[model samples]
Target: MGRKNDIASAVIMLGVALFLAGCPKQALEPVGAGGPQPQAQPQQESPAMTPEQPAMQMEPYGGASGQGAVRLDQARQDFQDADIMFEYDSFSLTAEAKKVLAEKARFLNAHPGMKVLIEGHCDERGTAEYNLALGERRAKAAQEYLVFLGVNAQRLSTISYGEEKPLDPEANEAAWAKNRRAHFVITEG
Candidate 1:
């Protein structure tokens, strides 16, 4: 009976050992030359992904105290020869517009005694009131830039004709672009 009991206990121990051997092994340390794998890097955020700001921001023009003598004929000529373009539905001057204005400024500086009126115009897109406002904005932008470029504020005046005066009369992009401008007319002459 003792021998039988001993044999049963030995069988039970063998079964326990087989069960543990069949179980999966836990990894105690990293494997080969690759070692511990590095974690994936997070993606960087981009400025382009963000929404843009509003377009109506007006920069302040430092007033006209630093002006010099300018040529009248040259200024008039430059004003006549200057070509300014605006974006669709906008009166803001682009880099090209700025370059033209700079030349105009040089002319104005040469002719200091010349007093001119800047006529603001717009294409026939919106209501008269809206167009008038846009035209005024264009005129004011030109005037302010001139002031910044050392042209006397007193010599510069602004007016808005809105869509009333169409330079091309044709209802096309070129005509509309032509209409959306700040034209100079010598008011004091």
Candidate 2:
């Protein structure tokens, strides 16, 4: 009985030793042969540039000549919302243009007192007179669409700037496409 008890105790001790040997170390010790271990630290990040950052090139706008005027930022937003476009020498609105005009009309209808001036533009392709006429047609097209969409005609007007007010002055297809557009300007109280 004494021998059996000794054997059992030896077996238990052997099992515990094996189990501990197989387990991962709970405490880490620094190695004397190598340098100190690196401490974890938060990484520093570079500053990010945002839209509020100053533009490289800024154009200056003169003060309003009339009684009531719209903010330049608001005008820009209106122009974006308008999205008026024309085909080569065509005054008719495309399906997409009509959709955009519908939204514009809805906006104008909502703001009954607001007045908008549509400025017709042209690419530097046709004769000055022809371009002017084309511009008028384009502006009128947008104005008519607004009227059709229930915006009061009395609250809207059209102007033909022709090729004079080119959004992109470059003589490329992209510039031409950009220049050939009908833009919005708020001209009244």
Candidate 3:
């Protein structure tokens, strides 16, 4: 029984080591070896500090003052300038859509204060309910791609306008292609 327990313990230790090895290089390193870790920082002010003096201050999204706010507003405008389109009856993003999403992610990352609402729209082909669900999937796909590109998840939201909100109400292929898109709306900046 003792020998069996020893083997089990060794196996567990080996598994743990293998799991850690698969983790990112930064995760495996000791904190502070490269730079200060956020978790290691003291949450409270130093005891030597007096109420008369201000503690270390962190700047807002872009900068310290209204400059940041103005930049964020500009980023929001830039975000709205592009729309990511999807194929008919499909939620998958094309190469063009990915390029647009990459740009959107950059802007969203730069303006952390900016909040986006991704509205998914479909053409007037499928049933309203089916189109709504498809639209939701399309919006979620865009949201996931943006998050992957380093945009903060908290700043993004999604909604499905479905076939109800076609950019072109015409029943042609070109109009349908144009309508099947994920539209970006700046909810907050």
Clashes of 3: 0
lDDT of 3: 0.70
TM-score attained by model 3: 0.61
**Sequence-dependent TM-score of model 2:** 0.58
lDDT of 2: 0.64
lDDT of 1 at 136: 89
Q: List candidate 1 stretches off by more than 4 Å.
A: 1-75
For residues 9-37, write the lDDT of model 2, one tens digit per residue.
99776554433222111101121222222
Give all candidates' CA lDDT scores. 0.62, 0.64, 0.70
* lDDT at position 122, candidate 1: 87
Candidate 2: clashing pairs of residues = none
Best by lDDT: 3
Question: What are the C-alpha RMSDs, in order, of all predicted structures?
Answer: 29.9, 25.3, 16.6
Estimate, for each residue in 1-189, the C-alpha lDDT of model 1 and write its tens digit: 999999998877655333222211100011122222111111222221212211111011111111101122343465775657677668888999899889888766644446788888888877899989988899999999999999989999999999999788998888888888888876653
Please list the residue runs of candidate 3 whose C-alpha ends up more than 4 Å from where it truly belongs after superposition.
1-75
Candidate 3 collision pairs: none
Ranking by lDDT: 3, 2, 1
Q: What TM-score goes with each of the models?
A: 0.58, 0.58, 0.61
**Worst lDDT 10-window in candidate 3:** 53-62
